[model samples]
Target: MTSNDLGDFLRAHRARLRPGDVGLASYGRRRVAGLRREEVAVLAGMNTDYYARLEQGREHSPSPQILDAISGALRMDREARDHLYRLAETLPDGHRTQPRETVSPMLSQLLDGYTNTPAFVLNPALDLLAANGLADALFSPFGKAENLARMTFLDPAGRSFYAQWHRAAEAVVSSLRQATGCEPHYPRLHQLVSVLTESSEEFAMLWSSHTVYGKTHAAKELIHPEVGTLSLTYQSFDVRGAPGQQVVIYHAEPGSPSSQALSLLGSLNATRRRESTPER
Candidate 1:
């Protein structure tokens, strides 16, 4: 999409927000709605011309300082600020979009060696790339599914996998919505959302909310059939220069009973896979 698309998104949000939302008084009777560009410029300590250029799609690049000022003026939360940056990067100027690169073969092999722990690589869209044996087993909720978002939001087994499934589900859907606002016309993204909406009522309802969110640190408690309750801590590390890919590692606390249970799960997975391999 063009810079105009980003401009329109900002403008629409600007119009939708009541002056009161930003701590301004709502005066009676005005032709235009919400905070005016001049008001925002005053709040942000920016010149009207520069802010106007940004709003009209005439300006493409701005510094972090500028972004912070405008974001503050708009009363944007963390999620909205992130969306703003994503859109600014989408501008037709020489701004660089982060790259999506393949995970190193060594990393994939290393995950397999974990053998006893559940580990996988996920794209920003929550597509499952490579996962270990136990990871696969824990993911039976997906019934051998490929997309993480779909399994989490659309499947029954998925619902039962997480103790706080609804909360987890909301995060996934909200993240996707944020991604969409950042790249609204992304064809593959559009297809992903379209498929989920058509396949699941739960997804359709959340998608309509137009909510957005940023990912910080998150913890997950999953019920694995073999392991019982696996309380896992997840750390998401950015694969540098790989725009949308992350190295997500999960670990059960050492010396905890859950760790021993995970070992059992790993053993069982290996045995079953070995049996199936020869038979196949």
Candidate 2:
């Protein structure tokens, strides 16, 4: 990574925020956009010269305490904070030291038990390592699904499948940014980023922002070909024993129309399973 990368990232996020975002009053016509370097330094409780040097890549070693203060001052979320620490080569709190690429059999079985919910396991690169039948059905729109990042950016159906297409696409790229910070040497991730950046202009733009995010729990809307429109809440868990692997499960509110639609899809899936099983 270039020395300017960290500075660029900080500048980009800083440029996106306004004075009012961090509770600073907007007084006069600003000569430059967003919060100025001095404003950030004041908010972070550090010297303006020091903060400016950091942004200019001249200040190399910032203490963890300083990083923490800056993160809060910048109003960075957990994921973004982690990214900041990682970019600076400081060990982030709760960052997995070991990144596993494969899912364990026990976890795979655990996923299968969630019959009513769509559950799948993904690696740092967003490769669909293991998925339950419901997840398979849920993602069937991307025929022969391989990687979530690829499916989201490459396939035309992705725009239709993701009801919040722009948000979803942005989040996907941000997640990839987080993954890149986690494991910079992963060849597959490098290839995926290259392909998406080359193919999709939207992806290229978001990727350039250097925003890092990880999927945790969020509301998602999907327009499924078979089940129609369904709103679901997804929760992501880091597989403790597996390090880099994350298990994501999707569910709808009980007794909701989306829930009923999911049930119908499950029933159809069950019938298809039975039909495919030879007489025994």
Instruction: Give the number of the best model, judged by TM-score.
Output: 2
Q: What is the per-residue lDDT of model 1 for residues 1-280, given as tens digits with 9 covering 90 to 100?
A: 8648667867876887777777877676777887888778888899999988988988988777787788788888766776788787734223325335367788789778876677888776777777877788778656766777878876777777888988888888988887776555456668889999999888899889877896656767888766688888877776654566666777888888778877887788778878888653
Quote the positional error of residue 262 for candidate 2 in Å: 0.6
The candidate that wins on lDDT is 2
State in Å the error of residue 47, model 2. Answer: 33
Tens-digit lDDT string for candidate 2 (43-159): 999999999998999988887888888888888887788788878888754433446777788998999999999999998888999999999888888966889988998888898
Q: What would the TM-scores of all predictions be?
A: 0.62, 0.65
Please report, as a residue range, the 10-residue window in candidate 2 with the lowest summed lDDT. 91-100
| lDDT value, candidate 2, whole model | 0.87
Task: Give lDDT: candidate 1, residue 116.
Answer: 62
